[model samples]
Target: MNIVLFGATGNIGKVILQEALDRGHHVTAIVRDPAKLSVQNPNLKVATGDLLRPASYEASLAGADAAIASVNDPDPDNVPKQAQVLLDTLAKAGVKRFAWVGGAGSLEVAPGVRVIDDPNFPPAWKPSAMGMVKALDVFRASKADIDWTFISPAAHIEPGERTGKYRVGGDQLLVDAQGNSHISQADYAIGLLDRLEKGDAARKRITLAY
Candidate 1:
């Protein structure tokens, strides 16, 4: 498969890039800073472009099988706008499959309560998490030609060893007996790429945790 990825330099994006390359798929990463992507593979191609300027990379999406977006805008106000740009661009490029790295905050902890709204939720993480929640909605409401999938990582994701093993769930948060939600970055990458290859959670939000 030929995959076009946005935000190749981000935390989750880096692992996704490596997983795609390791699986022998052709990858074209669109990023603002190409230097940050240190992975070298014959199948890997890096294209310099900004998500805000979709026209700049329309050519890059041509002939691509799928697009996985991991773009993160620290500014709360810009998250939805950036997500829309990517979706619109992919739609115009005629790509049919789309998957985005999403957030767990939007997942309901209680009937109507969200993680981001929890009083115990960290103040520093609220902006980014809430942004992702909004972005998730944008993807869900899109009526474009693309078949989109939104993959939300576990509540606690960080660099860790990949056991090639993890649990999957839908909508609600995944937690263990100890009441913890976590997943290694490596495993998250594995899960995302696996779904990309199998077309598992088409047009839905699937989450990963312990």
Candidate 2:
């Protein structure tokens, strides 16, 4: 499969890029700074562009089998709009398969309540989390023919070893017996690329955690 990936330089994006390549798929990574990506493979192609300027990268999406977007913004204000632009561009390009990296905060911890709404939720993470929540809604409300998948990571995602194993869940938060939610960045990438390759969780919001 020929995959077009956005945000190839990000923490998660880097792992996703490697996962795609390791799966023997052709990957075209679209990023602002090509130098940030160190992967060198015949199947890997790096393109320079910004997500805000979709027209410049339209060609990158052409003939692509699927697109995995991992774009993020520190400013909560810009995240939703940035996600909208990418979705709209893909729609216009007639790309039918899409997968978005989502936030755990939007996942319901209880009926009519979300993690983001919790009083103890960190103020520093709210903006980015809320942005992902809004982006998930944007994709859900789209009228396009695209088959979108929103993959949300666990509440505690950090650099860790990829055990090449993890559990998958739906809207409810996935927590261990110790009452902690966590997933290795490597395993998260593995899960995301696994879904991308298998087309699992199409038009759905799925999550990965230990």
TM-scores, all models, native as reference: 0.96, 0.95
Cα lDDT, model 2, residue 52: 85
Record all residue pairs in model 1 with backbone atoms less than 3 Å apart, i.e. clashing.
none
Worst 10 residues of 1 by lDDT: 71-80
lDDT of 2 by residue, 84-173 (tens): 787788878888788898889998889989999999999988888888888888878877677788999999899999899989999989
The Cα RMSD in angstroms, rounded to one decimal, for candidate 2 relative to the true structure is: 1.2
Clashes of 2: 0
What shift in Å separates residue 140 of candidate 1 from its native position after superposition?
Answer: 1.9
Local distance difference test, each candidate: 0.88, 0.88
Pairs with steric clashes in candidate 2: none
